[model samples]
Target chain A: MSALDALQATLADEHAALYTYGVLGARTSQSATPALYDALTAAYRRHRSRRDQLRLLVQEAGGQPVAAAAAYELDGRLLRSAQVQAEALELEVAAVERLLALVAQSSGTVREWALTEATWSATWQVELGGAAGTWPGAPELA
Target chain B: MPGRPLSRRTTLGSALAAPLALAACDIDPPPRESESSPATPPPPEDSALVAAVVAALVRAQSVLDAAAAAVPSLADRLGPVRTAHAEHLEVLVGAVPEADLPTAGAVSVPAQILPALGAVRRSEQRLQREVREGCLAAASGDLARVLGSIAASTSQHSAALATEVTS
Candidate 1:
């Protein structure tokens, strides 16, 4: 994939993440599940910032930024806190995969940025009550 | 996922360079052009970066082992971290030819559980930084991808360790 294509792919994934997190946040109650609520809120904001950054990166690379879909498919029941956390973890893992591709396709500052983002997403996997896998972004290695 | 175009070439070159680089570590010999075929040039820089990362991983594993031994109660918690390091080392070693790579230096762990966990966490954080730097410095995109994933995994280890230290 070209660097621009990788950026667009990541941007698209961020859009799905933002949409899913927004729904997850709504399902979470601050009073009943303060920790999950806070985690979702933080993830939502981070994805937003990353979306914006990716848009700029795509433009800088002389490509049009990919548009976010109107809606994304969600699986399983998200009514429970555990379910919500699981969904968020799944999204974060997907984000890491895209960011890893960006790291491989790009170079210099862009690659550095992708690597940093991938690291954060990997940590988020653990924070969301997921296993800290041997390989976070590279599934082949795992 | 689609594979990178250069991945095959890079992997082959890295596999070939691994044993030579590990062997050079003991002798500290100069780079030898004749050692590699002209079609597959020796990746001296990548080899060096890989060696450095491998060394760091060895040190991190030793520290975790020492910490686990010092605090038997924390052995269960440290087990997964040690496993992760072992798996990482295995994958890295798989990239190179079979040779005696550098071993870990002596690591002293604190007797106190919390302090010992802190030491392990610090080692992980340092390894994460080094691996991240190596990812950026890597010549091959394939190697960079591997290093990037390793760096991410190391960061997760560091974060997990931090949580353990505090809680």
Candidate 2:
């Protein structure tokens, strides 16, 4: 696989990840719900950078950058005020799960790109909501 | 029902971007175990890398084992998954014949959230660090696949634990 292709893959996964956190940020209070806000914002920046990195790689490889999608399927809540935080978590976890599977499929340069994306996505799982931040010594939910 | 198709409005920005970001979602491909072992070589290629994987798997296995043992009724699902991990461990151990992946030995899994999370976090962090470092040390495409698989599994485990806390 090529670097451009891997970057394209990350662009998509991060897109979903970003969308999910957006929902989570709205539903619960920071103090009560957890500082998932910080995690989400960090993810947004990381993903955007990855998207850009992919573009650079594509440009270097003489290939056109992969474009983003029209509208993503968030956990059925786009405008906030929805009971979709858990659903959003599920979606993000599933997205990262898919990326892990994709990395297994690809090889060479593309695989390298896949690994990078998967590693970061997993970190979000721990940091944002699921396990990492949930436990003590974990980033505070307070 | 079938999912939505890649509509025209779903520009390269929307459709393609999602796939790229989640591209690492994958299973750990098995390591290539040769019919014969190699001789010679100094320092070794991936001692740390292999150790990291071994540690993660063992810790994971223990967590699953304890969890399954605690909730023995869930053996229906846990049984198969445990078998799968054992097999995976064998394959991983065989990959680096020279080194023995460290066993958890006597690490106790606390019944409470704090200690439990701490144990899991340590294992997860170790694997994550290895995955990051292994990407740099990998000599073959297969190794990368295995590393990715292990990392994903650890990620899933971490997420699973978090779900318990939330519930």
Best by DockQ: 1
Residues B45-131 of candidate 1: C-alpha lDDT, one tens digit per residue: 776787788888898889988998999998999888789888877767666554357887788999898899779878888888888
Put down candidate 2 lDDT per residue, B74-112, tens digits, no spaces: 445445435545755775666555666676765556665
Docking class of 2: incorrect
Q: How well does candidate 1 reproduce the true complex, by DockQ?
A: 0.30
Report the error of model 2 at residue A25, Å. 5.7
lDDT of 2 by residue, A1-142 (tens): 4334544555566665555555565665667545555655566577666657656755664566656566566546444423444554555456554554444345556556656676566555655455532111111101
- Residue pairs clashing in model 1 are none
DockQ scores of all models, one per candidate: 0.30, 0.16
TM-score for candidate 2, residues paired by index? 0.50
**What is the model-wide C-alpha lDDT for candidate 1?**
0.78
The per-model lDDT (C-alpha) reads 0.78, 0.50
